[model samples]
Target: MTGPDKDEAVERAELLLALRKRGIRDRLVMRAFEQVPRERFVEPVFRNLAWNDQALPVDCGQTISQPTVLALMTTALELEGTHTVLEIGTGTGYYAAILGHIAGHVVTLERFRTLAEAAARRIGSLGLANVEVFLADGRLGYRARAPFDRIVLGAAVEEVPSALFDQLAPNGILVAPVGPPEGTQALMRYRRGPEGLEQRELGLVRFVPMLSGVAAVL
Candidate 1:
């Protein structure tokens, strides 16, 4: 491959190195990031920004979060290959693809019908059979598939929904950006152990607010 394909390959390699230098320490998470091509999830006009450490606009006024944030949150989960994962905020289904690559199965939720449908197509295009995308309210989670071994909330929320907590399996790890909708939010990791729920902050990040109810047609 020559021209743009070659340039993108070069840029993707450099981006992986940059992510490592920035503290993406989990080997599995890093490998998943390495394997999932970011360009496929972004619009053609924004393909050039796919490898950058920045979020890009997507359908439904949402954004595909930057790779750094995705990697950090994923690493915090300490995800195991056998774990079943639930991702709240499918966006472009980018991170879900990464999770699918690293975990046993991934169920991602998006409030927007269009984004959910598009993301499903994107994941399917990659031939990731372990990943499933749904059009639903992320706040409620996918109840039929409860007790997820790992849960990642892609959007920031002022309060972590109790329903999601109920969906987390015992000894599971759930990572989310929790704080006010505006300004910076704490990237929190919650571990549900036999003793109780343990909490820790991964770092700070800015994400679009996680909304309730399904989005109406635009």
Candidate 2:
């Protein structure tokens, strides 16, 4: 292999090792992390640091989530191969791609059309046919495809939106970061059971605020 290719392989190996050290234990989640090349989803300027465990700026003043956080959130979902997932934020399409690798289908909503379109193109280039990127208000969830077996919100909100709960199927799991926009958030997992919505605190995290309405940008 060429020098750059060899270097990237080494970087990727180190990334996986870091993730494993940081408590990423699920074999399927680990495999998804390895198979999906993060460098492909990041902006070209930030591609060199793609394997590093850090959040990088994307368009629309948004940030792609750190690798460890992404893996932790995905692992928390406890995804099955037959599940359909709704992803609230499609930033750079990285997390959605991971879901696409593990789930039957992924419907990811991005508030900004530009981000949505760019993410869609990137996901398409990777031939992840099960993932769909849509420009919409994530706070409302995607009603047309309601009753998702799994849902993940890439942004932070003070409280879980009732609309999102309505979209979840029975026994469905939704994982998200919950807190005020400017403060540290808790990574929460909510499961819809016959008894009602059961909540669990996974850990502490920070993410961009979950905004209302779609962006006017094209």
Name the top TM-score candidate. 2
Cα lDDT tens digits, model 2, 126-166, are: 89999999999999999999889999999999998999999
| Model 1 Cα shift for residue 64 (angstroms) | 0.7
How high is each candidate's TM-score? 0.95, 0.96
Clashing residue pairs for model 1: none
Clashes counted in candidate 2 amount to: 0
lDDT string for model 1 (17-125, tens) is 8789879878888789989999899889887778887899988888999888888888788888899999999999999999999999999998988888889999999
User: By how many angstroms RMSD does model 2 differ from the true structure?
Assistant: 2.3
Residue 70 deviation, candidate 2, in Å? 0.8
Best by lDDT: 2
Which portions of model 2 miss their true places by more than 4 Å?
1-6
RMSD of every candidate to native, in Å, equals 2.3, 2.3
List the lowest-lDDT window of 10 residues for candidate 2: 1-10
State candidate 1's TM-score.
Answer: 0.95
